[model samples]
Target: MRVLMVSWEFPPVVVGGLGRHVHALSRELAAAGHDVVVLSRAPAGTDADTHPSSDGTVDGVRVLRVAEDPPHLEFGTDMVAWTLAMGHGLLRHALTSLLPGWRPDVVHAHDWLVAHPAIALADVLGVPLVATLHATEAGRHSGWLPGPLNRQVHSTEWWLAQRADEVITCSSAMRAEVSALHDLDAGAIHVVHNGIDLRRWRSRATAPAPAGTGPRLVYFGRLEYEKGVQDLIAALPRIRRRHPGTRLLVAGTGTQQEMLGTRVAEHRVRRSVEFLGHLPDAELTALLRAADAVVLPSRYEPFGIVALEAAAVGATLVASTAGGLGEVVRDGETGLGFEPGDVPGIADAVDRALSDPRAARRRARAARARLRTDFAWPTIAARTAEIYAAARPGPPQNLPRPKIPTGNLFDRTP
Candidate 1:
């Protein structure tokens, strides 16, 4: 099977997990003897004025990165405009011409942002369109104010989900959320948990950090609203008191940087909390190797890949029990689980990592071993391919697309 995947982002130009997720999934599919082509927008090419194919291979997957102008709209954030313009650039060549040439058997889109383009591709190519809704607006903006942009995104997502032959979600939690939000039957949605790459996250049982020093507790990801890093920061004052030297490494960049930095300053634990902004994979692996535990304070995560990566890297894992994280982290086993807003509980989980060194190491080792066997790219991609083969052509009829100006949308379908 040939799969053309449309997504807004792809590494090393990733803003979040979606790009890496698509990258891994596509690679897996390619390894399984499927021809997979991933279309994305990024700015790394010799030709500045043209869309660069990037004509390279990643774990058997072929990636063609299209170059486009900065997606800066007047009324919306870059995120909003990028979503729509990501698709707009693809139509430089007519969809009618592009689809037949690519000759894809399946048009698989990664999220709502790419729905329009994917639907358009599937329609033009006469192939099955499989829409994967990694996260929904309701889940993303549950506690925050959802603007017109979010509503428009959901409307387009609803249309694609209903029209596509199948909708792939990250977990049962997400499946339920999507079903309710789109008013679709739960059975129509398939739950495929995100997988981690063990090769990149491995720690060869390295030597520990200074003994008796407060253990290193790390959190790596975007400092976005849904990440709940603020909650973890709030719990830090308590964690610091129990273990004076316990270090907290917050890796990743976002709008929340100033607020989180101020949090450390206010708590007078500026020394304790190290804001290691946007670390490279080498740095991430080193930190995971040194850390006693990794914490994910996501308020809304479809699947916490960072927690999985931490486990794969031999870092004891603890994450909020919100959303699909429960499916990945087993309490008192592979990794610990805490309630979303429970600051005390968050502190307690971190304290447990600091106090029980041997047990934590054992759990980390176990989780790392599990990830090696279970989360390989080829395995995950093969399953994705199965979903594509089983899917039929066309989205279900009568699905509604909420209105948002195309100016702010990522038009997945040209």
Candidate 2:
């Protein structure tokens, strides 16, 4: 089977997990004897050997970086313009035979950023379009499109869903949310859990807690309000009361870092919490391995890729039952769960893990085993390939270029 994947993020220029997700999935698909081609934005000063102007292959998968020229426009306007520019690049590539005897059977898109090119190319090629909604603007904004930017993003997401032949989400929770928001049939959406490379972790030696150090509670992710890191901060004093020697490690940096720092100072738990901003992979893995329990108190999570990483590193999880994190961390089974933004609940969960290290270790072991077998990349790749195979081709009708709405967000007259 031949596959065409469109995404804005890729290797050496990853903004978040989406880039790594595409890189891993494409490589696995290529390894499985399927022809895979990726169309992604080429970052400035991209290495010529790895990311060429016309064509290149990364781990046996062909990758073409669509060059984008900077336009003198507002940030939002430039974003939309760049998206359409990348779409035009894809159009030229599709019309010409750059690769010998290679045509896409399916076009898989990652997010709304690449919707224009992916939908148009799929329609022109008469192939099925499969789109994975990693996260939705509605979900991110707490179940509402609050402003013009939010509404514009939500509109594009809805439009992309309508154009795609099949839609894929990272978890069942996300599928339900998408269905409720878009009024789509529940059966039409498929859930594919995020995966990780365990071998990279298995080779590392588990970092042990420093001599006489207290139980370490680690929170590693974007330090945003929706990420619920503040809830963890608020819960720290209580957690310390239960275990006086408890220490907290806040990893990763975001817009809320300054506010979070202020909260730590106001709470007067400055000595107990260490804000380690942006750790290297080695340091991150070591922290995970050394952590007594990892806390994820996300107010909204389409899927918690970091939860999987913590679990794979044999770290116990005390996560909120928000969106897809619930699917990943079962309450009292794989890991412990609490209500989102419940400071008391987060404190209680952390206390339980610290008090019962033996049980927490058992749960972490169970989680690691599950990740290795159930959420492995090869397994995930095979499942995604099956979805591609199952996607029926659409009519060979060349679609007109998608026009950005000028008035209403949904392109409908009010």
Candidate 3:
């Protein structure tokens, strides 16, 4: 099968887990002898004409990175305009470079960022469209479309879900969220969990800590509010009182970094918490392996890929039973679990891990073992292929553009 995957982020241009997900899936599909091509954006400041857009073949998968159109639009301030420009560039590239020579059996879109181009390409090619909703705007805001921008994003997500021939989500929780938010039949949404590559994340031997060193807890991901990092900070003081010499190492960057730092100072646990900012993969893997416990305190995780990373490195996990984290970490069987935003719960879970070194190691070993059967990339890719095979092609037809409702119904009256 020939597959064309549309994603905003890929490989060296990764912004988050979505890029890693697409990279791994595309490689696995290509390795299985399916022709896979990924359409992604080039890195910032690349000369569009000079830099070769097509990276011939990467791990058996062809990658076409398109440059953003010449515009002074900044994504931070003008997201909708920036996205529209990106979509225009992608559509133009597809029409000129791909159509005459190669065509895809199905067009797979990763998220809302590339929705416009994906929808347009699928319609033009007359192929089945497959969309994966990594996370919903409503879910991020805890089910409230508070502002105009939020409503716009939610409407786009609804349109994408409605237009796709089949929809895929990373977790059962996300499937339900997408169905409810978009008013789509729950049966139309498929749950395909994210996967990990064990080869790259194997456990490494770490040098032993000095006799008086504290227990190191590591949190390596974005520091956004929804990630519950501040809650982890709030729990630190309580954790230290129970077990002195319990220090936390935070390694990530986000808009909430400054606010989290302020909270750390307010809690008076400043000395115990060290902000390491963003560390590269090598440093991060070493940190995860050496840590006493790797904490993931997400409040709205679609699927916690970081849990798999921690498991692969044989690190004991202390995670919140929120969204997909509940599915990944089996309470006592895999690692300790806590409720999201529960400061006491976080402290208690960490205390349990520290109190029993043997039990923590045992659970960590179980988590590592489960990876071979449950979170393997090949198994995930095969399941995804089934979805593709089941997708039926249909003729392209015009669908009404999604409308965002203003508070006043008569605002548009002349």
Clash pairs detected, candidate 2? none
Off by over 4 Å in 1: 44-57, 69-82, 94-100, 143-145, 202-212, 395-414
Q: Return the top candidate by TM-score.
A: 3
How many clashes show up in model 2? 0
> lDDT by residue for model 1 over 1-414, one digit each (tens)?
988888877887776788889988888777678888877766532233565545466778777666665434432346566656667665443354345576888888888777767777787677898888988876777622247666666777778777888889988888888786766799878888788876775545443354356667888999887888888888888887887777788889988898888877877777778787887677678887787778998888888888777876677888898888877887888878899878899999888877888888877877777776666666777778789889878533554444343332212211
Worst 10 residues of 1 by lDDT: 405-414
Whole-model lDDT for model 3 versus the true structure? Answer: 0.87
TM-score of every candidate? 0.88, 0.90, 0.94
How many Å off is the CA of 138 in candidate 3? 1.3
Model 3, span 1-414: residue lDDT tens: 999999999988888999999999999999898999998887654546655567467899998888766677777899898888888888888889877899999999999989999999998888999999999887786666679888888888888898899999999888877776777888879999999998887546453462347788899899888899999999998888888888889999999999998999999988888888887677778889989999998888999999999999999999998888899999999999998889899999999999999999999999999999888999999999999999986666566766654443223322
Give all candidates' CA lDDT scores.
Answer: 0.75, 0.83, 0.87
Q: Model 3, residue 344: what's the lDDT?
A: 94
Is candidate 1 or 2 superior in lDDT? 2
Q: Model 3, stretches more than 4 Å misplaced?
A: 45-52, 203-212, 400-414
TM-score of model 2 relative to the true fold?
A: 0.90
Cα displacement (angstroms), candidate 2, residue 187, comes to 0.9
What's the lDDT for residue 92 in model 2? 63
